[model samples]
Structures are given as structure tokens and as C-alpha cells.
Target: MEAVNLNKKECKFVVAVDESEESMYALSWCLGNLISQNTTNNLVLLYVKPPPPVYSSFHAAGYVFSSDVIRALEKYGSDLVKSVMGRAEAICGKFSSNIHVERIVGSGDAKDVICHIVDKIKADTLVMGSHGYGFFKRALLGSVSDHCAKHVKCPVVIVKHPEKR
Candidate 1:
């Protein structure tokens, strides 16, 4: 067996996370399998919140939603972001404490946000979770991972969670 060199240049890994079990599984897998303890690794946890809903002051039903209702919707979105990030951070905490982690929250289409952020941060690799959509479904839904794999400058890893029997 060849001896391995532990000391190497630092690598930045950008992981795209969302409020999904698949994403969390991908994050855990990346931490356990890909990250090197000897080299300084930057783990960037990225969550892209959906763009705010566009609602006219007057609804088609001829009634306008109260400001309170709008505020509640906005609050729910904010809370969801916090919840996802909190879970991601908890996973990181369970992994090697030596790995440096950063949390980035962006608002826009997920595919666009992920690709743009990966390019902007100059990530060495982009990691994402595969939802395992069927060909028909994926074609209709437009897979975000597929888009990132083609668009992002860095290499992209799409981890698929093993299905339980």
C-alpha cells in the first residue's frame, strides 16, 4: 500500500441542503466519507429559500389578504430556514469538530441559487442529495442536481440515500 500524505491544500466543499431527509443524509455522507481530518476543509452549508409569493393586493375572489396574513407567511418561511440550518449545524457538530463550517441562506430558484453560489464561492466541489425521481417525474419537475452538475464550474456529487427494504 502506498503511504498517503495527510497535509494538502485546503479544499472548499459547498453542500446544497434543504428541508429534506435526502439532503441531510448527503451532508452526513460527505462529512464522514469525503472530508479529510488532516487537511483544512471548508464546509459551506447552503439553503435556498423559495422566492416570496407574488400576490396582488386584491385576490381573484375579490378580497385582499390582511397584512397579518402576509406577515405570517413570511414568518413561516423564515422559521423554516432557521430549522433547516439548525439541523445541518447539528449534523456538522456530530462530525469532526476540526472542519470549519459556514451557513449561507439565499433566496431564489434553487437551481439558480446553488449554481450561482458555487461559482461565486469558487467551491472545489458541490455536493447534493438525489431525490431519486423517476425519468418521467424528473423530466417534468426538472431536477436541480442535474442542472447544477451541468452548470456549476466545480465537480458535483449527487449522493443517493439507500432505500430501506
Candidate 2:
């Protein structure tokens, strides 16, 4: 085994969170286990909003309420991002208020956006929650954590909820 340093150092950790309970659990786990009060830790909370739906002026059902509906959809997405970040910040506050926390909202596929942001930020480690999908379901739907583990240069930690296990 390689020798590891336990001394305090500035470390940046990117945590990918969503509306799922699993993600929140993962965030909590990270705060409890990995973070230390003595160390300079940068906790980045990343939320990726799904790509907006492509809609024309007329819907498939021949409805012409595109602008109003699109605006509403956009507003909802923005609100959801704020809500998720708020929850995450609340969790962080419960953990340690001294730790530096950064919130990032990205719009795209979760896996791709996560990988890109991790690289862009030069994160020391990436933490995320596993959906706990079985083999067949994971194979069919593809796992974001799995893809990120394979693609990102940083070490990836996929936290499986206790209930999932």
C-alpha cells in the first residue's frame, strides 16, 4: 500500500447532488467522514439540470402555447436548482460552517456535466451517490457514477445509501 498523508492540506472536493435522497445521504456521509475541521477543505456542490426539451411553435397536439409554456418550464428548472442548492447548503451548515462551500449549476447530461466540471475545477476528489440499480437496470439505463468514475481523472467516491445496502 502506498503511504498516505493525513496532515492538513487544501483539498477540493466536488460533490454531485440531485433531488434524490441518495445524493443527500452521500453529501452527509462525505461531511461526516472525509472532511476534517483542521484541514482547508473546499466543498463544491454541483447540480446538473436536465437539458431543456426541444419544442417548436406548435406542439404535436397542435397547441400554440409555446412561449408561455417554455417560460414556465425554464422558471421551474431554475427554481429546482435553487431549491437543491438551498438544501445542500443547509446540510453543509449542519456539518461545519467553516468549510468553504461553492455551488455550481450546470445544464446538460449529469454524467457529462459532472466530468467536465470536475476536470475544469481540478478537483482532488469527486463524491457522488449511487442509485443502487441492479446489474440489468444499470446496464440498460447506464450509471452516471460509473461513467464518471471511468472518465474523470480525479478519484471518484460513490456513496451507497445505507438503506440501499
Candidate 3:
């Protein structure tokens, strides 16, 4: 085992995941590649929470939401996100943690929110799985990985699972 820098903080990296095999595989791949044997670089695992029905807030100032309303939306949405995080942790534990993990859930388009978060955290690398779920599901998810790969300024890595035999 290589000596780890106990004092240095590593550059942040973002991995957008969902409750899917592709997402999990992608994260695991990133852990092995982007991370060193031991580093403090923040590895943010983000799952985009679906927006609430009554939680519509436009960018314009025309919409005003009460604090209580915001709280309720967050309260419910955050709970869901945390639940997903728990599952993510279980998967993460199976691998060695060369980087620190921080789970986040944002409500919006997965690609947009992911990009925003990447910028917000100044991510050194962004990793994701190829969007094609075989052939059928691929049409629906479109290709979040494809979108992010094109948009993000940071280095983007798309982890592709082995082709079916």
C-alpha cells in the first residue's frame, strides 16, 4: 500500500448516480481510476430528487414561496435523497475509499443540476456511465452521460460496462 497524504485535501470530483446498475458500476469505476490509494479529495455522489407537485418556483421574482412551503418541499425531498444515499453507501463500502464521499440530492433536471453542482464545487473530474440501458431503456434516459460529457468544462469520464456476450 502506498503512503497516503493525511494532511492534503484532494480536488473535488462529482459522480451523478441513480438507483441503477449503470450508475453503481460507473461510481465503482471512478473510485478505481480517479482516486489515489489515499487522498482527501471530496467525491460528491449526487442523486437528483424529483421535483414536488406544488413546488414550482420559477427563476423570476414573480413567484414567491413561503418559508414553510420551502421547508416542507425540502423536508420531503431530502428524506428521499437520504434514503438513496444509504443505498449508495452500501455500494460504496464494497470498494476502497481513496476519496471522501459526500452525497447530495438536488431537485431539477439531472443533467442541468449535475452541471451546476460541478461548477459550484469546482470539480476536477466528472464521471458517469454511458446512458444506453441495453437498447430499449436507452431511448428514454436519452443519454445523461452524453449530455454531461458535452457540457462540463472539467474532465469527464464515461464508464461503460462490458458488452453483453
Candidate 4:
């Protein structure tokens, strides 16, 4: 395991964006620390979208889809997007246009995609939230932040929990 000695602000940074509060908090931390009062650096906020569920058979289509379910899903997704956008806006609000801020939506394993982007973009630093999930669950389920910290070659910054943050 690597030690916590990241100095990401000196180089281009990539921060993963999810609907989770942990990731958001970590993003906030990156914005506050990495984005300087007068400097240009790229801050990419990535949001990973889950692959929509696919119905197994067209025969079930005749049974009529629940409008509520559809509405619920739409609302859920929209809310999620808005939340991330809001966090980004708050972080870069004070920065000049030179500070590149972007929102990317993708569907895939967050870890693989993040590592790929980090490599392709040549990002030197990565920042993310802890998701507050326990270490055991993180080891078993594989947290997004954890995956990035493990796979991405660049330095990673993980926003700790509220108390620690």
C-alpha cells in the first residue's frame, strides 16, 4: 500500500464524480486546494452512469410499463446529475475561465474507465471521496475511489469522512 503523500495541485488533476456525498466532498476539497487563486489547471469531473436495466423479453412490453417506475428513474438520474453539477459549480465558482472544468458521463466499471482516462489524458493527480463505506465493504465491493487509488498511476486524494474532512 502506498503512503498518503499526494501533492496533486502541482499538476493536472482528475477527480471522479459520483452521486455519492463522499465523492462530492472530495471534489470540493480538490477544488479548494488544487485550484489556486491564479493558475490554470484542468479539473475533470467524471460521472459514471449505470447501464440501464434491459427487459429480457419483448413479450413483457405488452403487459404495460409502470409510468411511475419510469418517472422515478428519470427523477433519480436527473437529481444525480444536478447534484454533481452543483458541487462542481460551487468549487470552481471563484476561478477564472482558464481553470478548465468539465463533466463527463460514461457507462462502465468506474475503476477501469478512471484509470483509462487518467492514462489517456496524462493526468498527474486524482482526487475523490471515500464514500464512507467501511474498509471490508470496500475490499469486497470495490469502491470507486479505492479502485482509482489502486489502479491509476497518478497520485490520488481521497476526501475523508465528514469528521475527518
* Model 2, residue 30: C-alpha shift (Å): 0.6
Writing each residue's lDDT as its tens digit, candidate 1 over 17-46 gives 887777888899889888986678899999
What digit string (tens of lDDT, one per residue) describes model 3 on residues 44-115? 998876545346654244677777777887686667566667877777777766657788777666777778
lDDT of 4 at 152: 83
Model 2: lDDT equals 0.81
Tell me the number of clashing residue pairs for each predicted model: 0, 0, 1, 0
Please state every model's RMSD to the true fold in angstroms: 5.1, 4.1, 7.5, 6.0
Kindly report which residue stretches of model 1 are placed more than 4 angstroms away from their true locations once superposed: 1-7, 54-63, 132-140
Report the error of model 2 at residue 149, Å: 0.9
TM-score of 2: 0.83
Q: Please give, for residues 1-165, the per-residue lDDT of candidate 2 as tens digits.
A: 965667747888898888777888889988888887777999999988765543346666776765888788678778878888899999999984458999998876678888999999999889998872221233246788899999999889999888878
Better of 1 and 4 by lDDT: 1
Query: Which of candidates 1 and 3 is the stronger one according to lDDT?
Result: 1
Candidate whose TM-score is highest: 2
